[model samples]
Target: MAKSNKKTKKADEDMSKKKAEESKVKVEAEISNDTADTEENSAKTSEVSVESLKSEIDQLNDKFLRLNAEYQNYRKRVEKEKNDIFKYGSEKLFVEMLPIMDNFERALSASEQENIESKVLDGIKMIKKSLDELFDRNGVKKIEAMGMPFDPIKHHAVMTVESEDENNDHVIEVFQDGYALNDKVIRPSMVKVSH
Candidate 1:
């Protein structure tokens, strides 16, 4: 009976030791699982942060592109406005000079009067030449309308003359001179076309 009691005690101790070891192993496994879950959560958070940063970058890039496009359009508009200002800035000045030009034309036509003296004619011719030189220096040019091909952009037909030639659909005469400023026609030539 004593031997049997000793054997049962040994068996109980062994079973207790086995149960303790199993409990330790279970605790360790739970800790490992918790660590793994924490690592997975950390990875997911990092991925979310990366996606957020990418979205912000995309938004910034879009804003940059929009601003760039707006700046480009603004530059173009400013350039076009500057060009228009330069082109039309002298319109009023040129308009005011028209009367002087008309007077010059009258003086030239009256120089053919019967009572005009030679010295007076020479003086008138010098004045007219000086006026023409001034006009040329100020970017003013006279349109060539007589004996040239008819161009609606530069010539206005006031009358039509009958002609037998087919090539007569052209300018035959200019009644009043036309002027241009820097290669741009300010006024079309008043012309008679042959037809």
Candidate 2:
């Protein structure tokens, strides 16, 4: 009976040990599964964060490019305006000189028609030549209207004339000469267009 009791006690201890080991294995497996799930969640969160960061970077980059282009365009526009200011700076002074040139032309024509004294005519011619040279140096140019097509930009048609020799819309006669400074017309020619 004593021997049988000892064997029974030993068997009970062995069974308890086996059950504790199985319970420990189950707990360990549950802990490992939880760790794996946590790692997966962390990876997914990291991916989302990376994607969001990339999207933000792209938006900022696009905004920067647009602003840079706008700045470049503004700079170019300012440069062009500065250049134009320099080019047309003396336009007002040149415009004021047109009437004086017209007076000189009238004087020369009257002198020629009246058969003025040679010395007086020579003096007038010299003054006119000096004025012409001054105008040439200052980028002043005459708008040729005689025998050309009537251009509203450079010519102001005061009257229409019937002509057999000239084509329609052609300048038959120029009543007043036109002048331009640096390709910009300051005064338009008064002309008669052929009908």
Q: Who wins the TM-score comparison? A: 2
lDDT of 1: 0.85
Best by lDDT: 2
Give one digit per residue, the lDDT tens place, for model 2 in 18-72: 9999999999999999999999999999999999999999999999999999999
List pairs with backbone clashes in candidate 2. none
Locate the minimum summed-lDDT window of 10 residues in model 1: 108-117
For candidate 2, the TM-score is 0.77
Q: What would the C-alpha RMSD of candidate 1 be, to one decimal place? A: 4.5
Deviating ranges (above 4 Å) for candidate 1: 1-38, 41-45, 48-52, 113-115, 118-123
Give candidate 2 misplaced runs (Cα > 4 Å). Answer: 1-31, 118-123
Q: Among all windows of ten consecutive residues in candidate 2, which has the lowest summed lDDT?
A: 83-92
Q: What does candidate 1's lDDT look like per residue over 1-195, in tens digits?
A: 999999999999999999999999999999999999999999999999999999999999999999999999999999998986787667667757766786878876876665566887787778778878977777778899888989998999999989888868798888888888877788888999998
Question: Number of clashes in every candidate structure?
Answer: 0, 0
